[model samples]
Target: MKYLLFLSCLVISITNLYPASAHKVEVSGDVGGTLHIEPNDNPRAGEPSQAWFALTRRGGRVIPLSQCNCELAVYAQPYAAGEPPLLEPQLEPVSAERYKGIPGAEVVFPKPGIYELQLNGKPVSGARFKPFEFKFEVTVAGGSTQNSRNLRDVNGDLVEGESQKLPTWAIALPILGFIGILVVVLQNMRRSGE
Candidate 1:
């Protein structure tokens, strides 16, 4: 009877540590490797992007995480007011125990802001399936501010490109903003003169 009680206690402790949602997400996979999104790695803009993660089990049980048919959702919220509105949340499907929603997959940040990725899955019976989630600070490539400039290296020189470089939109923003202000000022002057 004592042995039975001790065994039960040990099982409870192990179970407590292996909650269903123990996975951790990060920009780099070195962490828990729940989800890793490469900068400018977005494959499809209007469509869902592919995401890959190694699903693992916490116990000696013979169940697979893939049995749960995990679902992934991504959301983005702008950090600044007066910025563009938030984008519609995206739901992606998982293929195999490893997740790959869309081919050439990428996490699309409609605008620079804090974004969250959520993972929900069910494990085999007698196994815990906790919902996993992580938030990443995504500064989109283009914005009105130079500090937001996304620059890339070009043959030892910096050039504007989509990945790790200044994007064309980044260059255009200041110019466009200046032109917009000029037009507004001129219209106001004309109204005052009249």
Candidate 2:
């Protein structure tokens, strides 16, 4: 039936509306797990982006910020030897699922390009997750990136990790939906005229 075909097309288009938001796994010495960046993977230039780390050990014990002396340093990609870090954002403990009191910070990319965020941590008191130095390569796009943490959303409410900018599916799905509707209408007209 035409209706059934239209419903199927609608379902397919709706399912592609979400973008990938998986936390990135980092390669470090003994203390490292996942790193999550707010507002999606590719942060844009001239906006504050929040980044956090979820560290675990062999037994999967969570490493809280209270137990580690961590430092974050950012460097431009293709960095030269002995070059100083471009910026060093202060580390703060952020509370969230699996990242309760974990090391996090806000960073603003000055321009669009490839950059590396490096995290080095050591035990503050007793040895927690062993010393680690994690590196993550982040690509910055040339535009203004806004997130709920730093800006108002569609509902004028602040919700972490949500961006106001329209997503790829938001643009594509509407076009596809319109086309599907048009097809259904055309099919109905043809049948009625018969």
Candidate 3:
């Protein structure tokens, strides 16, 4: 009987050892015409800057400013595992992509890793300005931002999206209850026999 209780506790402990990783967000879209990025240099303060991209005639001509609240936003993450990247903005617009960032936004690639840029605009129907998006990669110098991507896992390995299951407390309580029930039933049977 004691051995059963001990075995249950051991099982619960082994199950609850590791931490879990959070779910990652993914953003993707189409790159219509010439995707223009300006200067393509490290950003400096008090500098006039801009970025933009053109759409092919097939995907529709220039995205009208009025039709779509044409605005650009950028994101960056590690290349190996698809995860939610960080966001940075000076006021609203970034001046990297030719200020052409008007139709699509310019993303600042601080770190030297694979990054994604999203050209977000108000949704449009048929002849109107259809929503557009595209994902691209950029490399930055090492240690660019305060928060960097930690993709590696335990045992000094790069274990992305891999997390351990079940916390110790969550597994232990159920087993303890089961053992208590078994002990009570066995004692009752012995008493009945006497």
Candidate 4:
């Protein structure tokens, strides 16, 4: 019974060691669908950042890229209080329902501040869907600051700051649980032999 309890604790702790995928922001479109946007990495000032967008109907059907003409517009919130700077972000279709920001032509925030992304487009050719528009807010951090970090993973891929560190408990508890389980199993086996 003690051995079984230790094994169950070890299994649960091990399962929680690895973190889940980062969360993406989702917005409902005015026309008739939901827009999902996932940034390749956290947006940094003066650094190019790529993001993926997907459009899906209320019924969960994906809208094909060929059937829609879409564009993304980026605007930086003014610091003192003037009008924001408007920029056109280049985007390319990745598949029927997915689009990615072009690497070189991707959006780069001019400074660390609040930014707004406006997505607009209409159904193309023979598509009967209405024009869609979406707006989302993004907050960038440590832009051009003295303490700014590259924020890339070991594979040179961009990652959010929150995901940079593994929780201490997540690692320590799993290891401790596994060690306890091993000890319990060895003791049980020795008693059974005797």
Judging by TM-score against the true structure, name the best candidate.
Answer: 2
- Candidate 1 vs candidate 2: the TM-score winner is 2
Better of 1 and 4 by TM-score: 4
lDDT of 2: 0.80
Better structure of 1 and 3 per TM-score: 3
Q: How do the candidates rank by lDDT, highest first?
A: 2, 4, 3, 1
Strongest candidate by lDDT: 2
Off by over 4 Å in 1: 1-33, 39-49, 59-65, 78-105, 124-140, 143-194
Worst 10 residues of 2 by lDDT: 143-152
TM-score of 1: 0.34
Residue 122 lDDT (model 4): 83
* Local accuracy of candidate 1 as per-residue lDDT tens digits, 121-156: 554455554543335333333333343345656566
- Report the C-alpha displacement of residue 91, candidate 3, in angstroms: 9.7
TM-score-sorted candidate list, best first: 2, 4, 3, 1
Please give, for residues 36-103, the per-residue lDDT of candidate 3 as tens digits. 44445332222322435554334534443334444444565543455444663432332332322234
What's every prediction's RMSD, in angstroms?
22.5, 8.5, 16.0, 9.3
The 10-residue segment of model 1 with minimum total lDDT is 24-33
